[model samples]
Target: MPALQYWSFLVAIGVLVIAGGIFAGLTIGLMSLDETNLAILKLSGTVEEKAWAARIEPIRRNGHLLLVTLLLANTVINETLPVLMHSLKWDGYKAVLISTALIVVFGEIIPQAICARYGLQVGAFFAYPVRILIWVVYIIAYPIARLLDWILGHKHGVIYRRSELKELMALHGEDQEGPLTKDEVSVLRAVLELRDKSVLNVMTSLEHVFMLPLETKLDRPTMENIMKAGHSRVPIYASDRGCIIGVVLVKQLIINDPDDAIPLSDIKIRRLPRVTARIPLFEMLHVFEQGGSHMAVVYDSLPGQTEQPGESSRNGEALARIVQPTWTYASPRQADSSGGNVLGIVTLEDIIEELLGEEVRILGSTLRACVRVYMEITGRL
Candidate 1:
């Protein structure tokens, strides 16, 4: 009878160990999936990926409950076998040693290694059974899970503010989170900042921006002056330099007879879109894309007492520029009160450069030819 009881304990220990292995593997396997990968997998991936996604979905949704259940079940089995051995007249210390060795080897080491290394393969293999286990166990586990949920409160997902997201990217850039490298994070950060960029960030200020007056004859010297200003696009104003109306490409100078008696007004061109200084730069890019135009005029709001032009604002400060589109220094009498001030000039190239956070090399053939002509005439390198 004593021997019979000993054999019974041995069989019970073996069964408990196998059950413990399933619990251990399920815990590690289910948790190993990244939520993003799982989501992507569900949305039209390969057959194997879709299969794994389907298998893992339920366990992932009920993760907390599944985890707690697995832990509770393992704990019960581990403790019960040892107590059962002692009940069969085995010594306490021997029972403890045997149980610990078996649990550690079978319950943790073997199962964890298999799941960790071939998680998708082995995990998908057992996913259905593990899923069934959760459902069966959830009936018992839900009350405690609900009570804990009530006490702690559940968040559907992480919410980050723009500043917080920047900080997180900075942290990842430093390699605190591992996989992401600094350069990659920097690109990501630049993209995030694109939405926040205003026309003021990229537009050439009014001071340096080249504006051709309608009264000025379209002569070689005037064309040279506009080209030397290092801008591919120039604004044309009527009589006053402050009242810009249309934009012209430098290439137009190369194609046209600079000696033509045509007034600057006769030059065929598109009117510039007027954009507010504070509007998002991305919106400007989108419009240029949809409308197929390159240049925009940036206007400014009334300067606050604390915030001045060419300096930082106390609220959402911006970099300084020469012109405030739709804003002017002229008195009401001198400047047309109806005509909004030109804050600055922004080109498609400027927005592209801003998006990439680097200057895009767009050397014009006309600009180069003009430079070569000047170089040959002066005989300087």
Candidate 2:
């Protein structure tokens, strides 16, 4: 063959190889972008059935096409180069070595590595174009996708599973470089807390609660005596503390004269709301929001169930009912009422301290468990 025709053929093969390599790199880049988009869609709960199907179908088709095209281009170049070298009277071994080195280093490794690392960034910049391509392919592939969907009994769109969120949380925890900072760890722990914490975790036990007998006459000296003891609201029970009738605000008592005989029924606030010990803390927040009250009365504590059974039941039930109810105090009226009856008085400050203490205890236990598990797994325990 003529020198120019031979050189032309070699140049064409080189161009084809380079083109295939670029497409391969772009395919890898697109896959990375797809993963990121899926992550965002999952997190935001915005992955519509159509959109998710549309998002993935084109990538799959293009990826398949790209793989075949690259393989064919690679084979053609690999075969053509040796023939070209032989015809040119060049050493076939030398040409093969140089071409392999060039393709591996420049065409494959460096370009693909760059694309992989910055895939999402490049994908974002090219999103408009890629989206157009995806749309075009989606239209063409719709029939096949629909057929597959029908056969597999797979629905289109984003269906949220609890497991997905758990996996995401676990992935986030794993991605942190070192020990997470206090705030970061607190946030992650708080996410986990949504599932774990219940009303019993933060409530005050009934033993420590100050309650007033419902039959007790709202006599001057009696109210005065309770006030002197520094209780704000006192739970008014019909016969015993367990039979709570309502909560009485001491401030309401102050509004009456010291010597005045105030009727218990008139002074007492009716319709006191009570939360079950098993209620989740997050759900309990809504109760606090609607009640326009704080300081909930926690009922009976079952015997032998305390974390420290030896401790008095009094302290255990008191500790259990002290949840910090979630409420947005947009104005002064929404603020916690000071000086209330002590069916159980849990101040915002008290709740904060309790939560902080619980977090510390949980973190300590978690760390110890992790260490123990690790040691056992490594046979170093």
Candidate 3:
């Protein structure tokens, strides 16, 4: 080879080696960022990362096509390096040895390590060139890509299942120095799990709830009992204890005359939102958000029972027969006839407690009234 030709071939060999490395690095780096990862980065990543994700996503989405293109380009560049070295008047063995060392270290190892760490940034930077390369190899790559797609049934983006998400949260919780606190991780895990739970899982059974018969008088002793119960709302039942008609707010008793024997029926009750026991907590939460009563009467329908037209409320009793109500929130103005026997009372606090994964002692009207009464006696209120 002439003097100028020798130097030109040497430079060409150097260029080929560098090109091969970039192709090798991109195969691992760019392809490592699967479709799902790019989407998440596009949505919530940093400004730079978001831009990179957006630019790279179009190429990344066609996984098999991009994979074939990158691999083919790298092979050609690697093969060309030894040939160019042979042109520089180097012997076959010498050319092969030098090309192999150069391609392995500079082309494959270094580029791959760097690209693996900063794949998104590097891929975005070279996205235009990659697109052009894809076009250059379109004829060859398209057929192979289609074959792979046909065989493997196009790659679907992987997403974390609810159980997997919970496991991930648990793992994060175990990391003491992680951004998420243990409590936060617990709450996240609970949020993911809330859908699996039903009202039956967290409710105060009718027998255990502090309730009042509609016929009972709200006199001094009754007022004292109401204040001592520490419940924000008390279920009011008529005729049968199993037939809970509505709930009376403990705060309503503030206007009660201590000496007067007022009937509990005289106090207006907030109607309970009735829901089937099988309703998921997530849907139940939407019902609570719709306004009216946060507390719902959960009833289980008899086997083989389906929904009936129009709610049945004769007198003040909710129908003890099987009434399978739809997921819709029932009206709070009138008592909803639950077709089945009332199983339990589910309060808003119950759902909240489930979300927190801990028992939360909410300060009730009883505690507030006690504090106010003490303050009044001490002349502090």
Candidate 4:
């Protein structure tokens, strides 16, 4: 029994070493396979059919290689062990059973559990070596890949897709652990906003927008009134909302005489940046940053739509009677749909307030403690 136990222990060590080697080989081979697949894709044409074929062909070839290698290695190891044990005068069946059990326990299960626990760290440690192996395999596989391509009568080059890059970005976000920080979540949300949100979602509605009439003269009282309004800039429009002449800064008004008969056209900053309602907010942010402007105007819905009169009706008689223009800005179209034509305005302050509100709710206990500490430290009740 003691001798049997010693033999079993030795067999277990041998099995673990062999299994580790196999694992390392497969890991290296899989890395090579991935590189080859990418190369094939890179050399293929931009056409969808060609690209798909290029990508799939390499995967199929590598998968076949992997299956064959695993099968052959397992067969050789299992058969040779039994034969060697028989020659050594050990009971063939008992030796084979002991070796197989050891392999399963020590070689496969235990090592795999350890690797799984520290997979990312292990992968990072071997990253440089794995990369070198991939580069070497790519060069070696190039001729074979070309030959296969020729035989298949397929295209020889690949064009990378932007969708693949986007997928990589999403995969990165998914792999991160736990809940994302506020800023990280915001950045990720901002990225998604590029595709989903249009300029209309971020823009101030036409009703809420302040504009100067092209014919209006900038006199003392007019300038004073504009100054008192607390807006840094105002848009100048022609006869209607559609013809936006330009934007005028309040500081520019200060530079000119208050009583000067200044036509809005003379003070108007021409070629003001404009974005359609359908433009994405992420793209609009870039436009805003580039143009040094903080505001955008959202247009009203198309004209001539009538509304039914009811309590639930947004444009009902009750609302029409009760709603005052001074309460909010309204578009002409909104007035037709409801009693008013105004969509809600969202300012930077509004966004900041909303974020702060959410943060306060989430960190209620921390905030309470912080306040208490501050009050105690300052000797204030």
Instruction: Give the number of the best model, judged by lDDT.
Output: 3
Candidate 2, superposed: residue stretches over 4 Å from native: 1-14, 35-90, 125-181, 215-233, 250-264, 289-381
Query: Candidate 4 regions off by >4 Å?
Result: 1-75, 117-180, 219-230, 257-263, 273-275, 281-381
Model 4 lDDT, residue 253, Cα:
64
Cα lDDT, model 3, residue 110: 99
The residue pairs that clash in candidate 3, if any, are: 21-107, 321-339, 323-339
What digit string (tens of lDDT, one per residue) describes model 2 on residues 1-381? 787888886786577556545545655765554433545544664445335534444444344333333344445555665565566666777878876775777567876887797654444454455555445555444555466556664433345465575555566666657555555555555554544565566766667766666556666557546644455566666655556556666655655543456666556454354444554555445345445665555433322222332222233243344333222222111112222233343322234444454422443244445434543554434
Q: Model 1: per-residue lDDT, tens digit, 220-322?
A: 6675676567667767777576777667666665555555635665666556656667656666665466444577776664332232322333222231122
Please give the RMSD to the true structure for each candidate, in Å: 7.1, 15.1, 5.6, 15.0
**Deviation from native of the Cα of residue 1 in model 3, angstroms:** 3.1
In model 2, the Cα lDDT at residue 372 comes to 44
Residue 39 local lDDT, model 2 = 51
Q: Please report how far candidate 3 places residue 343 from its true position, in Å.
A: 2.3
List TM-score per model, in order.
Answer: 0.74, 0.55, 0.84, 0.50
Where is model 1 poorest over a 10-residue stretch in terms of lDDT? 314-323
lDDT of 1 at 152: 73
Tens digits of per-residue lDDT, candidate 3, 340-377, equal 78898898889999999887666675466764584356
On the 0 to 100 scale, the lDDT of residue 256 in model 1 is 50
Candidate 4 RMSD computed on C-alpha atoms after optimal superposition onto the true structure: 15.0
Model 4 lDDT per residue over 1-381, tens place:
377865875675586457554444444433333444445544764565344434334433444333333444545565565555554566867877866775676556664565565433343344454444434456445555566556664433344454564554465567657455545554554554344555455556666676677777876657555644556667666667555545666656655554466776665363343333444444444434433455444334323223222123233342222222112121121122222232323233223333233321323344334434543554432
List lDDT for all candidates, in order.
0.67, 0.51, 0.78, 0.47
Q: Between the candidate structures 2 and 4, which one is better when assessed by TM-score? A: 2
TM-score of 4: 0.50
